[model samples]
Target: MQAKEIPVSKSDLLRADLQESLSHSHIDPAQITTFQRIILTTDGTLTEILEAYLYEKIQLVKLSQEIVASAQEIKALDLNIGTNIMNRKVLLQGKISRRNWIYAESVIVPARLDEIYRERLLKSQEPIGRLWLEHRVETFKEIIDSKRELAGELSDYFLIKSEDKLLSRTYRVFSKGQPIMMITEKFPESYFIDK
Candidate 1:
């Protein structure tokens, strides 16, 4: 599917004062209420929350690993999980920069033994392909909004946080991080590229 750019001004997106209101933890109740209404109207479920968070967390793990190799510090990352049960689209890009690379080495925490066991069971019962992530935020405000969207994506992810802030993610951050990365475009099937 083709993608469309979000129609928001750079300055509006980079607004400094509202940083606290961007994430699930900080947004005003009214703002959250709007999202709540949307979810309720669409009959969203608890499982959707878990699905989005799991996807986002897996993405950050890879990012943290990539950032570890660099000096930039990734203060925050937002990974777009996917369409919800209702198919509302959202976009997020986990991002890092040379200036912040030293601070951006935060990644998702490791899973518990029970989780590992569950994955083992699930893998045996059903084949699952590996997920991928890309980073795209350019400023702190986007970072904050992304986090909230991430929380909205999956409430459970709210429990996941920056642990051992210096740890590396599974994927490589590479030499220069892209500001507009398409982090997780899961292509399970091999498709033809014009180029």
Candidate 2:
């Protein structure tokens, strides 16, 4: 059976002001280049990029994953799973050289996933991109938006002071034409620092 394509809602596109952020930002050119490299690239796992840029082994830390009935916003993504739909909220961190480089949260539709994929997602500490590649799941990513977060829990997690900001992007992953996951990743400014 062919997977049904999930339509992107107009509201979802409008909610993210990515164009303004990318086109009008005053961030340094090098930093902008780094952001584009990380956020714009549809290929390769982020772990690979971090390893190459930071010159260190990356570690995946699974903070939490819990099954929930639904998040209204995630449900709005219109995943094709039937009434059995359940959302998995996953929080994890990527560290390099013992320093946290990225924090990520994902709203995954377990009902839409194959049994093997669901098991791997729940049990593995590997990056999701790596897992997708290992399973040879043909997938496509849609970058919904990007932003500069100046304050909040994410900044606190990165130890950013009041005046500092973190770069972030929100995206969705689709496999077999079905929307399977929604992810938001926040990167610390230190990731762009020159060695």
Candidate 3:
């Protein structure tokens, strides 16, 4: 699968929205720089970047997986789900050195996938990037939305202050010219700090 160029809006590239959202009311130039490096870099997978940053293996901690009704957003992505489309929700934590650094949720259309890939997704604790690589699936990611907000559970899990918001980006992954999954990743502030 060949890599495709990801289009970015000129406003998004020039705006400080990413920095402002990640840094509460006050902006930190250093943090903004790191934020841009991580969040705005569309060249590689999050697993790859996080692994490089932490200098440790990124482990996928599967929280849960269940079949569910498709949300309007998922449906609107033109996934080509039939009347009985099998939708699965997978919740996972991306951990390094046994510390949970990222919380991710993926909405997958199993019916759109082959039997082998579908089973791997259901049974394995591998990150999506790894799965894609192993299966040789070519994908295009479009970052649809992003936000900075204090999530209580995420903060508690990451041992962060309740007032410190986590930065999150939601993106859709397209393969074979069709939307296959939507993934949302929430990163704690500690991820941006130098160790």
Which candidate leads the pack in TM-score? 3
Candidate 2 positional error at 181, Å: 0.4
Q: 34-123, model 2: which lDDT tens digit per residue?
A: 445455334357777777766777777777777766534444357433333433433334453466777787877787788898899888
Ranking by TM-score: 3, 2, 1
lDDT of candidate 1 over 61-169, digit per residue (tens): 2222221121333333223332111111111222331111111222321121135533442233211112111112122111222222222222222223223111111
Best by lDDT: 3
- How do all models score by TM-score? 0.18, 0.73, 0.74
Q: Is candidate 1 or candidate 3 better by TM-score?
A: 3
Where is model 2 poorest over a 10-residue stretch in terms of lDDT?
Answer: 82-91
**Pairs of colliding residues, candidate 2:** none
lDDT of 2 at 190: 49
RMSD (Å) of each candidate, 1 decimal: 19.5, 10.1, 7.7
* Backbone clash numbers for all candidates listed: 23, 0, 0
lDDT of each: 0.24, 0.64, 0.66
